[model samples]
Target: MSKVPDRFLGYAFCVGDVLLELDMDFHIISADGAIKNTLGAVNREQSFLDLLTESGRGLIESSVKMLTGANRLGPFVISVGQEGLAKTEFAVFLAKLPTAEDRIYMVLSKPYRLGKSDSKNAPAQKTEDKKREFFNRLEGLFEGNPDAAENMLVTVLEASAGQQLDDEKRLDIERYLQSFSVGGAHATQIADDKFAVVHDKTTPKKEAADIAAELARATGVTLKGATIDAAEAKLSETDSMRALIFSLQSFASGNEGFAVDQIQKNCSTLIGETTERVRAFREVLDEGRFSLVFQPIVDLKKATTHHFEALTRFELPPIIKTQWEMIRFAEDIGLIDEFDYAVVNLAIAKIRKMLKKGGSPGIAVNLSGRSLSNQGFIFELMSLLRGNKDLKQYLSLEITESAKIHDLDLLSEILDEIRGIGFKVYLDDFGAGAAGFQYLKKLKVDALKIDGAYIKDALTSKEDRAFLRSMVTLCKDLEIVTVGEWVETQEHANLLREMGVDYGQGYFFGKPSPNFLVAPTAAAS
Candidate 1:
């Protein structure tokens, strides 16, 4: 026996929404039909039935019965059509259906003549006219009685097929069927007959049908089927082949072609706008349209300077007036990484230059979670440090506590490797979110920078004070130094010092300055 395609067990019943899953273990009947299960299991059987019950299939059946009588096939067809519409409107709904089953029963009957045939360019014109009239009737039927729409649609399908449709003609018919089956605003476009009904829950069935018909008319192909054994056999050959074939057949041809053209139009417009923004950001970076600002860290006991945190400021042109505006534009155009990398490299170089000129205070540079988690970036930082030995001791790598810990083992190993070479690691914004004391022990960092939120409100709030104190004690136990950030006044600094915080950073000492300076003896004292 020939092997089945991997998706052979998956099948579509109704045009847009009636999908069925048939594997050895259990048979699953689904509406809003998209193949979901490649291999059936018993668990999936119960789940499918449960899903149908939840979708109110019973209610749908009752409604169809009221309109189409007890034959059930009529109601079943309408329910299938309704499911088609549901699939387009609700992504969540479609996601629930089994996508890998292929036991589909497509109904194709002889084509029905609506009017007397004309002989003038008759064959081509007749096909167009027939499609237009058929879709128009379908729209009216769907609007008037959605309960009976599926049955009527099936009736239309049965009436529309000529004795035996060639493969190309059958594909066109299938696309047309799918368009109406998956109804939404896009359904109205069925008149165009160029696009395939690639399922987009948001599109109207009429529009989708028009596009599908046109595409089907363009590309001569018909619906094809595969059994479970065939699909599994294909998987053994190549995993990508199935996905590739589906994408090409569904999106690149017939009714799908029209929909893709529309998508391409929208994408092109977005691409153009994004391109302009990217170009503008590149110009700014190229011209060094940014400045480095330093914020002072104070020593409470001596009322002296301890260190400075480097902050980046973009010098916007008159056209780009706001900091947020520039930043948002950069993010939208994929220039965020470029801008951040430039800031990092520039800050490092600036710190090195300042140290060479006898600047004494330690300088802290912020490293985004993205950069820190990147192995290439860590190596780059190491290379920079290697080239500038004199500034190594005075530099600290500040990282956010909430950054995703990508590959924890690798991150710990890298931290140890960097620390081994004399670079200090400070967990910035520590005690934020769910960051626990365990991270302090596990990460083996040199220091923890108390989140600014704790310092800003800890003075007045008992709860905040207790939390900060507990965190400070925890750090102490682990031999990890603690630094209080956003210290705004002498009282805040004094309170932090009393809490055992070894360092502080905020506006109280001095605002960020371009000129780097040593810690004043008074502050250190």
Candidate 2:
């Protein structure tokens, strides 16, 4: 706590938005507003910066250096410290009082009310959905997808531009730049002015610079920026995620190659072990040793199979991994896309065969969101599916939210194209992620599979049941079907049906087996 000017105190008191006072070290001195209701309990001992996620922290840290004359910090579509909200964006405004230069003031504003217009009767929604789903999806993504681990080239580019453009145009350009993906690598905006590109090991340093240059031009201003490359770094086995994130933060701060050392530290064992696993995994993909299992999603009203979801099962010796564990490993090694293509091809072939039997039940094959991020993969998948467009009725695509899709708008467009070909698309594990609401807004899907966790808890927890009922009502309003998973008993099914879930799938229904009646895919469980 420090002395503050009376005029500044008066202004801070009158400000209706969430406000915070921070020392020069960015430690909280004071706080006001309903922040505790959303973000969490305010602890004055904590660094004000600690409240922010990595990217959000990076944005502030980057801006701090240029704050000498600037008072206003952002209207950046900045993600706040809060998790699991329907909308993650907050419009941030930061200022430094002329008389009290030792303290920085921040205000956070957003459309935060849940299903309300700020009336007297309106109440706040529970936070578990936002918190649990955020951590769950992040854990799912952090574990990696089905692929081998390899050295990667991570490059950070910090630019000076966009001051001349309007906020919407600037955000649009940022989104466009963030869409840059090569193979398994994707670009993420660490700071409003900084973009970090994670590229394949084969990507040259010069090539990474060129990517920065191209994106820099998209800012619609004469921007000059420096690119730093953390070339050929092996993330540490024990703390790979922390090391990776810290490295990005350092890069955003214009630190030298110090970022690489964090990841490279104690990574030798990881390198040797992963090399062998990568080899074994590649062989599995090549050998075509996987089998297909079909789990029927039953329509609640009709009590019949609406469609069957195709799942993968691996058959191998020694090293054992669950379906998702293998998928994450594959994603880590950057070979999941190849595995995805193989599965889709097999699915098409099977659909063609089923069509040969005169009357065919439709099959939905899971496609990793990571693969969809790659334009090359999307183009190839579209080409392959278009070639077998006649099987569109018998085949559907279920988007597995295994990885974040960088260009969601592009994906929505592609999904529309696929649906135009008469293939239904379903979003998997809906409401199991922080971005589900954003996803539902952007994507036009025929159906969504409610996360199994929600379904498992629905019968016991009134909160869970309430959320499901509300979700089901929203889906019905949108004219979209809903599927509940992990249904183990008749009671569960009945309750879900009463809540207006259109379909259901679980062990109570027949479990998945090699009922595809054909040779299975070349890769993965």
Candidate 3:
């Protein structure tokens, strides 16, 4: 690499700013006085990556890999200085050096200043902030005692269509929920498309049903709702809340078609198992007692592994025989996030090791709806992966059809943010849920996993086969890849390939294996 031009250096030095010269490997060969002062002797002859946080490193790494020209690296916010010391916020920027193809120049800007808030946007931001505050407050209302004398009934309402509810309709829904606010009953907008009503056991079932109907009638919007009464639930306060969350989610997704009594009964079953389930969940976490197996998704034409989907297996007591049962229990008890985090971390760690050894097929992990809804958890996850972002190219996140996305806009924003970080997002179980093709329109995703039910029954069921073929055609038109799930036979594989499906994942390819090296090479398990 050639040295930076004298004219550029002179200008950079004159600006009295932090500047450095870096090679393709990101090792700094020279540094200005500002950088020397800021870094205190470690400014030169080191990779600039050493100065960044994990997420910053990931962002820069990705940007650097994709560097085409004099690209700006970041206005990345960071707290600089040694740990436990007074730190300063700095925004770092990097540009590929024009003089040398394999070198770059960097500048650091300090002390972030806020720009003028747009008058129109200020109110929206405030409203969203207030909504978050209200959500937290409502969650706190049940914190003190699980066995309180009176039970609380939590009902959540969401629009059955559209990305958002208009201001007037939104207000009417909120007001209706509020009108039921007598004694312990209160309501709040929990999401852009979601509203919640919390009341004590005293509220009648008929009253709850009538209010839901009235809200839909008044707003002229079809709304879905789920009501869970804590008094009837056999769970602790925390577990009960999760039950309510999932119940609401189930309703919104059009998955739970049961009456209110059945819904409560189901939640009660989940609650009753909480203590034992929680103990088992924690034991798995504490002991690192879970294993992940990778199932290859084969490309029919190429006959090579495009990527592997990581499936987790827990070493639980004999009573818990199936993985799905354990996962459902984990979901019911609010431990799904922890469980997912553990599984993803393990999967990523294994992938990193595998990459170091050899090979580069991508891996996709299933992310629960609960995890997606929790913004804090999502950010932390991104931060964790930011340092090792090159792994992102081979990583994907699959959002299941059963995962209830109450706020389409929020989910879209989250998906876009994830994609921006260099990972692909696949819609799992597409065409099986109420949203169906509608989900694809609202949320732009890289691929869709055709609902397994359709694939499994397609051979004998003409309707299922037609749906599968149509979905494949639609996806091809949209330039989205389609993967046939539960493809357990040669006939299924051939049928999917004939329909132009890009990938196949099922027992037909190979069963999942903890050791990828030992995984089967045959097309059929």
Pick the TM-score winner.
3
Off by over 4 Å in 2: 1-265, 317-320, 357-359, 516-525
RMSD, one per candidate, in order: 20.5, 19.4, 18.9
**Candidate 2 residue-wise lDDT at 140:** 29
Better of 1 and 2 by TM-score: 2
| Model 2 lowest lDDT segment of ten | 516-525
Q: Kindly indicate the candidate among 1 and 3 with the higher lDDT.
A: 3
In lDDT terms, which candidate is top?
3
C-alpha lDDT of residue 295 in model 1: 80
lDDT, candidate 2, 1-525, per-residue tens: 444466655665453356778877888787766666645766768786666666566555544432433334443334556344432455565667667777777766663422222212325322222222222222222333211123334454555544554445445544554333221113444444555554344433335446646655665543333332222223323234433443444445455553333333423333444555666766787898786789878777667777788898877535635766678776655567888998888877777677678666789899888788677898898888788888877788888865456668988998898898778899998887554778988999999888888889887898888888888988999999899989877788899888889989887776887783321110111
Ranking by lDDT: 3, 2, 1
Candidate 1 residues 1-525, lDDT tens each? 123333522432222322333332224433222333311232334433233322233322222222222111211121122222332111111211134323322221111121322222224433333443433333333333333323321211121223455445544554344433332211112222222221222223223234334444554432221111112212122212222222222332343332344333443332333344455567889999888777877666656766678777877765566876786555423245466667767877776676678765677776655455555666776676666666667777776533344445666777787687787888888877756565665688898898889889887899999999899888889898888988788788789989888888776666677876543435456
lDDT of 1: 0.49
Which residue runs of candidate 3 sit more than 4 Å off their true CA positions? Answer: 1-138, 144-272, 318-321, 517-525
Task: Give candidate 2's error at residue 124 in angstroms.
Answer: 31
Counted clashes in each candidate structure: 71, 14, 1
Sorted on TM-score, highest at the top, how do the candidates line up?
3, 2, 1
TM-score of each: 0.48, 0.52, 0.56
